[model samples]
Target: MPAAHAATPIVIRDIRLEGLQRIEASTLFSYLPVKRGDTFDDDKASEIIRKLYATGFFNDVKVSTEGDVLVVQVAERAAIGSIDFAGIHEFDKDALTKALNSVGLSPGRYYDKALIDKSEQELKRQYLTRGYYAAEVTTTISPLDRNRVGILFSVTEGPSAKIRQVNFIGNHVFSDGTLRDEMQESTPNWFSWYTKNDLYTKDKLTGDLENVRNYYLNRGYLEFNIESTQVQLSPDKKDMYLTLTVHEGQPYTISGIRLAGNLLDREAELNGLVKIKAGDRFSAEKLQATTKAIVDKLGEYGYAFATVNAVPQIDQEHHKVDLTLNVDPSRRVYVRRVNIEGNTKTRDEVVRREMRQLESSWFDSNRLSLSKDRINRLGYFTNVDITTVPVEGTQDQVDIDVKLEEKPTGTLSLGLGYGSGEGPIISAGISQDNVFGSGTSLALNVNTSTTYRTLTVTQVDPYFTIDGIKRITDVYYRTTEPLYYSSTTDTSFRIISMGVDTKFGIPFSEADMVYFGLGLEQDRLDIDSTTPQSYKDYVADFGRVSNEVPLTLGWSRDNRDSVLIPSRGYYLNTSAKYGTPITGTTFYKMDAQAQYYYSFARGFILGLNFQGGYGNGLDGKPFPIFENYYAGGIGSVRGYESGSLGPRDTSTGDPIGGSKMIVGNIEMTFPLPGTGYDRTLRVFSFMDGGNVWGTEGESTGANGLRYSYGLGLEWISPIGPLKISYALPLIRHANDKYQKFQFQIGTSF
Candidate 1:
């Protein structure tokens, strides 16, 4: 230790620094308050030492006088050479590294004993948040060569604490079960392992508390109060119990509801939006909804910064509340610019063209929301967010920033499976929905099975023109040989077909499109002595080789909220294809289908589908066997074999697809019990009724309406979409084929 000096100033001729390895001498000079030419004193020397120590780059700093010169010495702290973690099983290594880096405890940084202790506490705190009440984190420092050190954190994370019981007191209007049902966190059950709702955390408890409060407030408990909540932990710290005590006040009713404040002379319009009325029970949910609606309505009129406040005046004597809505139309703003960001793969124009909200236009909340939805529907991004920022110089101008996280839009599918009908199948396909980020689609598919082999190539240009017209071209070759499962004799023949089709879609509206198609097809049949009589007859009538030209017209409308997982929407499609008499084979086919989806609750959906098709020979000839419609599969009636629902060949007992088809399905879809809001996985219950009839038979009758009820699971896996179902037939004929369990990979239904 240096001795204390007198309170006298001295003139310094020179100054020197010592004990610097990595730090520069100039760096030390910059922090010193005393200069060589300036007078030095004890106070100045003290300031120099204090500032150097505050830099956190030194372990010790001292200043002393040597003759007419001032000498400063600093012992630099050891730099961290490496940081390692041991016994860390609960959290990911990358995540922990980031957390430690955020607290200034990373490799290549100077080591501080105080910061090391703080970092340990932070690690333990994180474990606590994850319900690891018995977690222990201890840090060790190992000396290394050349004034460097290594930090090692050993963590012991015990079992996560589980909630054993939850009790609510002072609840008269609703039972404890009812209140518990409203909470997202709960005690252990069959699904606790997946949902983790049994685990207790401060954030979960806070959210649960809010939910409880909202339940009472919405039910007209005007003065509901949660007095206290106690969370008791077991002595072993593996179990927890929670108790919530509350005071349930008297229920209240609405005496009067009025709209005050700036209505902008639209009092009638605003009043119509109010959901509350006099004599109705006071509901906090309804009040908040009404307030938000009014604000949104104002936003539609260019008042983007509007505010609506619901002020409740309570009459204690009568147990009634009068509601007043106060609106503030802050300013009418216009958008100055629309900025796009975070698109590393997709082109700017590809995303910008979908925007309905243009720069320099008055801000419309509906248009902005529609723009975001349009971007989402493109399926190019996993997440999309939009934020509005007021312009720096003006109050009436704002900028819109669209931030997106892009996802892979290309898919490669490879599948190998065995089916009862198709002995073994192998399929491979590659598709690019956003080809080169130009928003074009190209796909190539090849499927080979014992019964059928197909090769197809398709390309689509969604923006064939600047007006949003779409063009699609397809070329395919397919060969099919029916296999006889019940007969010992090989009586089946092979049919080969090659076709090319081109279609153009013209947009009629935002959700509607009209399509026109033209195609040319050639078919050839190979028959032998043991061929089926139906095939022989067809070959005799239509010849072995036939050519046809088909003209198609179609109209479709889609308003689905999401193409992948639609919660609410409707889809309608109708198409007709006619084989002109000018061509070889003459036939006409007409089909119409409609589907509707409704989200009845947060995670529940109801879907209805109906489809019908009719086809016949135009010039009094038999309908083409190759163009017949088949039903009863995963996409149709699940309880029956694929393509085995129509008329059957007498001797072969094989399904010969019919010319008329009718199908209807009703389904209710909900999230899995423990999946939360994950839409990629869902379980659904469905009832399907469908059948096919020959051209000579009736289109509809109770006898032919095959019905099946089943439970199905759908998962959008990383490889592709997968569907599995278990079904039971409601009405079955003696000869009807039953396929109770069915599954398919790389397809969507």
Candidate 2:
């Protein structure tokens, strides 16, 4: 055997396109991805030939040259005759047709034998997912008239398999019920396969194994491992069992931690940053993460090149491990570059301007990290990742690379609203969540009603520091008119205020966060006496003070994923307002919402939402209008007006300040038929029951719960999420309140 030597021995002078039946020669030339007179090596020649053949316009391709002139020859492929699908018990022909078309294998298009073969294999695999392990798919191409061929897919969907048993092997610490609960498959009932309960696949088995591993790891089993998993089949080939073997190794605890090498910060001082304490579970991965954290901490002090290695000295006899973190102190690397990526629709400047951390400086690891979090808080991205790329030439330089996944941040929403007595009203709102790349949000709300026009601007930084703190700020200038049947106080008012609030988030655990903040707000309140003295005195007790200062304290704990459509978790927000004549009375308020959603294999989703609010004027100044709770709307208790279901004045019959509100909605949202796999359009049915009433000591004729039931449409669009509903009051109760068939619409920002 002789070895080939590398050389540039061929130069492509003139390129003449030879294939010309169906495809244009110009298109064929472009397929070369290289021009005439370009030199060609074996790698390049092979690549060009492979690309041209990949176009599927040719069954054969050959490249030859004459006097430095390159010639490309291609044999066009045959056209498709018909795609015949059969034995489609699980899916229709049109379904399979669309699936094939997605991969460019439709009947009207040119036929690629390789693609058809791949599709056949995929179809067989797809059947396997549905528990048809013995399903067989055979593709045969028969020539038709005019060199056309028909793709015939012959299928045999064997008997569907049911999980006869699910066993947990090598699980000694936890009960078998725990492991079984994590499994997607269970012992089959009679005809469970027909009921879509017994369908199991390999993916499910693997996922269950991972679930088991995570369960143990999160519970302090640091060295837990999945040894193996096996599936056993019964004699009938219809019943199966999944057995997973796991090795729950000795659980080791942290004996002690030793610091070695370098400490950019004080050794005794930096010790506080280590979250993993002595006697804690010895997690190898968390140890590594802790080491990286140490390095990042050092970088915060301008020690950018710090290297930290956390080594555990195992004492298997005592089931304990001693940790040693060795550090390497290198010269602080300057940030030579900072780059932004994945802003496909948004302009670069938008994100760049939002960045408090700049480029071309001694890379402050703290600032760089804060910058990443600041960008993420913009809510314009699904994900934001910041990487430090080491420069090849200099040890003192590193480039910052920012990659963002842009998400829908702006919403164009239409609002078709109805009142308890008033007719339907159409309005629109357009809002931007990420504005000027500074992580600010801007919103404009307009209603068909003559008095409701508003604009709001808000900004927030999720990472206020290198230690992962979050800061949020909002300023709103809003003006709205109260649609009062009786013209008490002229029925309208313009109120504006500039207030700043800040909160500090304390991470108690992965799933828990404790937050506290303070706000100082100065509000100007004007009481217009356009109504009779009885109406004015009933609300304010006298002439209301025009302006006042309220010191506000707030606290909240959030464990939720989607704010708009939460499936599970709890959210709690409470605040106290005090100052001046209101200081002693505790102007307290609380808001809490809980949601639970469950989805089964049949595509059924059972969900419930509960929200409650309470407020007090604290010393009976007729609780502030803004502090009062308003209910009876689409987002609240449907089949009611936006703000017409609360407490009311006796003389003027206007909704006065309510002290408390409690609302609950049980919803079942399911995908609409004929929708694509994205399932963006959904239909939901709901029963909403809630009420707004007076507090323990207030006077405004606040009463009992108003009830409603409704059907709604939810659409997930590129602009935002859209929701519209038509609700009918179940307890209109002619005795007291306002109740009418209400229609409403909304969208998420």
Q: Worst ten-residue run, lDDT, model 2? A: 1-10
How far does residue 624 in candidate 2 sit from its true spot (Å)?
9.2
Model 2: per-residue Cα lDDT over 525-554, one tens digit each: 444645433335544543333234455555
- Top candidate on lDDT is 1
Clashing pairs in 2: 12-37, 350-437
Provide the TM-score for each candidate, comma-separated: 0.87, 0.56
422-486, model 1: which lDDT tens digit per residue?
A: 55789899999899999888999999887789999999988899888899999999998753442
* Cα-based lDDT at residue 656, candidate 2: 56
Cα TM-score of candidate 2: 0.56
Give the TM-score comparing model 1 with the true structure, all chains together.
0.87
